[model samples]
Target: MDPFADTLQRLREAFDSGCTRPAEFRAAQLKGLSRFLQENKQLLQEALAQDLHKATQLDSAFIRKEPFGLVLVIAPWNYPLNLSLEPLVGALAAGNCVVLKPSEVSKSTEKVLAKVLPRYLDQSCFAVVLGGPQETGQLLEHKFDYIFFTGSPRVGKIVMAAAAKHLTPVTLELGGKNPCYVDDNCDPQTVANRVAFFRYFNSGQTCVAPDYILCSPEMQARLLPALQSAITRFYGEDPQSSPDLGRIISEKNFQRLRGLLSCGHVAIGGQTDESDRYIAPTVLVGVQETEPVMQEEIFGPILPIMNVRSLDEAIEFIRRREKPLALYAFSNSSQVVKRVLAQTSSGGFCGNDGFMHMTVASLPFGGVGASGMGSYHGKFSFDTFSHHRACLLRRPGLEKVYALRYPPHTPRNLRVLLAAMETRSCSCALL
Candidate 1:
């Protein structure tokens, strides 16, 4: 079967059926998605490793109590399972039917998704479509009410441009060169501890992870040692052999990092064993502002630390670029935190923390400008998928009061109309 056509057809049928209107049906689908994930835990882990060398612990379920309407999900390979299943859980709870396009780079993961979703979901309602750019292009030719796309900004642009033909609203989860600032007031030890985790986790594949650290020359001198120590503590003396850390996603990603490191100075952990596709949790210091590593989104285990004169310099540096999916600031001072939050716009921000904002469903997650657009999580996700059909029902038999509004209006009629406008008031008082 043509996966895109068949899948879209089924979702259209389910949406038109009116089953999606019932809150009960939505809740049931949410349960099914979560149960399917739990039952097939091992399968998800295996497929992820084959696709990206990511650990199973990095994958987990998100909110499930809300429901949406009919949605098409385009997931990426970075965090394959969570990116695919988390939003699906929210969609079902919001009463949505779905057509999902799992990333073709991870062939095994796609098969696992196909195996599990049909088992737990209403088979006639939810469908998995598998293919690459051509299949995606074919699918986009059709009209969908909403699209939830997770990928790079370059492709996100094409998705959004195509969506415009149908006026289809979209949520684009895209990436950017995120900047992490270290203020003069920041504790060196605390800054090092937080930045190390944010820059290296998932082998630095996260969109919101700190792409590079902006610190003063004096601060970097103190911070460099602590960051190196933190990385060693988390991944052991040899990060290459540690099970806690994962490898870069693919060779293309590896070469990208290799080029960046070639252009910068290494302050700490500049080690790599390409034979096993392993790159150390290395930190690069003294990187030039014009360098390619600073110019692009560094999605790898490599961390490039650049020196800045002041917080103003850091803010100015970040301002010149596209709005990032996230802006991470580490400062105990209220003034610095307020200045960054108020002045800059990002999909989200974290104070004295990194990448933890995504876990909370209360805050709607998304990007702005070049970073991409729209947000969804938990109830927000449900709302994102379902369109609200507003109704303003009126009661009958209030003719006398409204009759005063008729033409040939006079003092008496005006008085009556004014009186009628007040549903509750002092009746006898000239009103």
Candidate 2:
């Protein structure tokens, strides 16, 4: 049986009926969503803890946003509810029906989103489709007007390909091995604290988390102990027992992270407990470019340090790889920070910090090249799910004025029309 057929058809019918077209209806749906968030706040947080162990309330802005019919939101396990709801909010507010597909990996969060979320919105205009890979493939067989996917690059490619079949637009929020450069001029302790906090936040499962560090050998020497200090201060002597520390989401991810620890010399925190799916917040030095940890996005509590002699080399090294989702550079000198920012390309850049660039609603969040494509956040999310229609209106009473270019055009008339068009162009330019 086609699992998605009934719900898709219902949403399609609802859209066709123009039920979601009215401004009041959209406002009501938004209100319902607000209530859902308010009523189920603790449940959502518990689900997040159960999922991979993870808010900003943003203000609404006025924009000429229009919905793109039915939208499919495929959210990742990491930050599952946030990613799912971020796009869903935009779609709903812009007046479109949505089919939210939360990650199957996070079963607890998936259950809450699939079961509890739908009740808050109109059944005809909203639905939650639960599935793994095979089921997702089946769901993609049907057409959607717009698709917003947040996950790995491999699955992002698959989503893009499926969207291609229907010529549907997509926003892919994918992952990459984001790099952080620490300059010799900066205070090692300050840089260490900032990097350590973000690197180990949510056990470093975040897509925009710093995956590796690029710095001079001297800087590396200073940073190693400072980072150790930061790790200890944040998670205490044993990260395994730290309440702030999180466990790996699954055995597959745990094994992958465990394999990464052997890539280079462990600088600090290399402990792992398979029974609890815990891998300590680890740092490695002397890592080679070809190593396994360097090759892929390290979506765990593992940090690798690769030595670069100068800022130029560090920028060049980042340029050679796929553009990352987020990039970081730490330096007391503003010129040094600006130089790195000007030299490298990333979806987002942060100086003297981590992925805090995503905290503000004004900034758009996304990836570039192999990292991913398109972006979403506050207004960007609304714009991503909307189709800007070009419209023009003209008065019908200007028959004689329009007839000059119709059939019998004299040379004088041609010159007059050309001059009028040029004048209009110049006027628009001035405006």
Candidate 2: residue 65 Cα off by (Å): 3.9
lDDT of 1 by residue, 1-431 (tens): 67699889899677644577678999999999989977996898789869976530112223343333457899998888889987787677667788999998767788899888689889777999989999999999888877899999989989998889998889898999888888879888888888888888898888999988888999888988888789889999888889989988777778778777875788787787677767888888878888998888988888888889988888878887888999988887988987787666688899998989989978898889888787888778767776665333333555554555676667687566555545443222121
How much is 98 displaced in model 1, in angstroms?
0.6
TM-score (C-alpha, index-matched) for candidate 2: 0.83
Query: What overall lDDT goes with each candidate model?
Result: 0.81, 0.88
Model 1 CA deviation exceeding 4 Å by range: 1-69, 404-431
The clash number for model 2 is 0
**Which candidate number maximizes lDDT?**
2
Candidate 2 lDDT by residue in tens digits, 1-431: 99999999999677645578678999999999989977997898689769855400011223355789999999999888898899999898889999999999999999999889888899999999998999999999999999999999999999999999999998999999999999999999999999999999999999999999999999999998999999999989888889999888899999999999999889888989999999999999989999999999999999999999899899889888988999999998999998888767789999999999999899998899888899888998888888887433444465666665554657676556655555332131100
Clashes by residue pair, model 2:
none
Pairs of residues clashing in candidate 1: 66-93, 66-94, 67-93, 67-94, 67-95, 68-94, 68-95, 69-96
Q: Per the 3 Å backbone cut-off, how many clashing residue pairs does candidate 1 have?
A: 8
